[model samples]
Target: MTAPATKPQAAPAALALADDALVLAQRLGEWAGHAPVLEEDVALANIALDLLGQARVLYTLLGDEDELAYLREERAFRNAQLVEQPNGDFAHTIARQLYFSTYHHLLHTQLATTPAPDAATEDTTAPDIRALAAKAAKETAYHREHAELWTLRLGDGTPESHHRMQRAIDTLWRYTGELFQDLDGLQLDLHTLESNWHTAITDTLTQATLTVPESPRTSAWTAGAGRQGLHTETFGRMLAEMQHLHRSHPGASW
Candidate 1:
């Protein structure tokens, strides 16, 4: 007798990566008029646009970008929990940026430098992935530097600012491990990626006079299942807000 066929899963790498960019871009775009200064308002918006551009490229590689981004249910999104996290305050936003941009820069650097496997000739997505990685690496490098500078300013600035920066870093540290977790179709060595990320984060924190949290990044109590479609409570609300207009308009486009 023939066996029953299993359903195919979404392309984990493309979906997850694209979701990461999309979610974070939404979060950053929230700072439009609320940023601490006019300069920060414009800066965050530009960064959000950059991330949105990246997400569009990645989503296009998968299928209908609109359907994948706007039509998907909350549980279907595969973004890392870190990116979906609510941007608490200016310092908290900077902390999230510090952690994610560092990881993003490192991950894209690997993708840009690493040669595609033999199967890439047949896999049309490989070249696009490489090109996106190459382009995004440059963009994320700026993101990393921006985060690093802010982390330093906030962490070392004043007593209140320092305390807030420290608290933000500690609060978000647990969500970071998921960044290094294995994803399908990514051929880079996770060990090296993680090690480099650790060193970079450590150096930045040390320079900022901030302490790296002793808390574990992954554990039963910490978040790690986002790639498996699990997420925090905040994600549902954020998704609703992000998809509201798109879903409401249903194919209406300017």
Candidate 2:
């Protein structure tokens, strides 16, 4: 008798989560030398490394981490458009981090606390995924707190700082809806995730004395197809830069 074909649905879901972490890590790493304060240089790098570690674990579960990260084409990436956005300024970076880390922490919390499937029906990778989620939840909590403090600092600082923080919040609002989009193979409640995210964001903005942007989360002009392999023009440039060295030195390693 022939063996049944193994279902590969989980790989795409894992890849999506992994891509989000990896791309955002790369974005944060770009701030290594450019952060406003010397301390921020180290802080941002630590957060980036935490995200990189999560991405590496997820990638290892799927396949070769280097090949998956370096060889994938732009359209092949499954990261949310929010994470791919340019680090416009310190405020922009903080806004992006605040938005994503909040969502990521909630997501990992759900994944970590979810009950494991029965042995009879469990897939081989389930335990590892849950374990990774558990560890990542702790790390992302710090990421979220760091972003929150920065948000408050910038939002209520001098006039220019307040203006930039508000602008960053408004500019990035549209890209956030995609965070709650359905991901295959994950049995999470999207509605709950969206609601919690909204509440958390609203509270933080209020505390910082910034208005929560009224822009629609999803609209004709908003981004939403990243999971379907569609990406923004800027993503293409970023991907090119990220993949350049690996492609240039194929099969060569230090």
Candidate 3:
């Protein structure tokens, strides 16, 4: 006899943002004991905690945070491909952080300031999203600054360091396109956000003496499929690792 079939889950905007934060938090947590310096160990841990906090808030909106984070299948995740990419080296990790933190900062800023349609309306979720954005925007500001400082240091430090920084930027450039895609619940004007993100990133790169990496051939017209639950192969392995312990012991808690 066949086992019971799994229920279908809807991919809402909050889930997408939560998955992005959760996946990236796990990636950052991997650097806990392995960071290049003691200061970075503390810094990265704090950033991971910040992302995990954001994920918890977002997950709470949907359902049980534990089950949503651990039990969901690979195809049900809605994070951008950029966050799921493996951290290749120090420069690569910084590059990823630089891109994503910048985007996150801008996105949250807009969400915080954008007024809801009707203040008297019964849609409480709008206020919650806005409130969360206000808090998250401040955290992401520090995250963006941390990445910016490291990018500058590495980009101009040495010939080898400069080369690696450039290479890292080029390698991850393709994944950046997916960050601007529209989501169901967020009524954001993505075009405006993308424009601001480009200016901010380009200015930072120039200050570091790094050229803006060329975008992928079709990136201007086409985006990655991460929002649709289509993720990179590495994401599957990461998901497995993240969920393994939780899956092994059903209902086990600290």
Candidate 4:
């Protein structure tokens, strides 16, 4: 008997999660060469590089690395809603970064030992997936520190800054639940992961001497299937800006 012909497979979902880190990282890049303060400007740039590194390694697994970064349509992307939200203000930007990067710290830390079946788990995802994740995990550890320091400073700094920071937490907090929720197969929602994440975030807040605003009921959970090519309006803009070159020229090379 002859073996059946196989069709070419696309990128893995977990690798696509790396895309979430990357796109947000790219958005963070906008702050580069233009942050309010010198220290933050350097910090944002470093964060952007870390994210771009994560994006490059994961995308390299499926095809040409540069093409995936500079190419591909918006609809073709599968990054999460949390990654695409607008930066709003400095406090808002830092708050969102704090929320997501902390999760990145947690998620990537887990991935080193326990990865999605399709990601590094198969042992074919790439040596870089583990390596890059390990590196990103360390960078994220610093991010957690940055966030904690800033959260305390901003949360207690000045009346106005405190108000803005608190409001930032209120505004961005809703989207956070989406992260810990079970996207089931797309993410590794380990046994009791959601509760564990809550405890973790709470513990961080305790040390920061702040609290995660209690939403009336935790904004009705809206699950976005960014992994399935589903996205919010912001993603459309992100796509246009990120892929303008490849879309305009259709595979023209540098």
TM for every model, in the order presented, reads 0.93, 0.94, 0.91, 0.81
Model 3, 129: alpha-carbon shift in Å?
A: 1.5
Q: In model 4, what are the clashing residue pairs, if there are any?
A: none
Clash count, predicted structure 2: 0
What is the Cα-based TM-score of model 3?
Answer: 0.91
**lDDT by residue for model 1 over 152-176, one digit each (tens)?**
9999999999999999999999899
User: Could you give candidate 2's per-residue lDDT for residues 1-254 as a string of tens digits?
Assistant: 12115644566677899999999999999998999999999999999999999899888887778899999899889999999999998999999999999999999988899787675544555566678999999999999999999999999898999999999999989889888887766667688888999999999999999999998876586445788788877998888888899999997787
For model 3, give the 10-residue run with minimal summed lDDT.
1-10
Output the worst ten-in-a-row residue range by lDDT, candidate 4: 1-10
lDDT of 2 at 6: 65
Rank the candidate models, highest lDDT first: 1, 2, 3, 4
- Per residue, candidate 4 scores C-alpha lDDT tens digits across 50-120 of 78877776665656666766666676776767778887788888788778877888777776666446553
| Model 3 steric clash pairs | none
Displacement of the residue 142 alpha carbon in candidate 4, Å: 1.2
lDDT of each: 0.88, 0.87, 0.86, 0.69
Candidates in order: C-alpha RMSD to true structure: 4.7, 3.2, 5.1, 4.8
- Candidate 3, residues 1-254, lDDT tens digits: the string is 11114311222677888999999999998888999999999999999999999999877767788989999999999999889999889899999999999999999999888776564442445556667899999999999999999999999889999999999998888888889888665578899999999999999899989999766712554435889888888999999999999999989988
Better of 1 and 4 by TM-score: 1
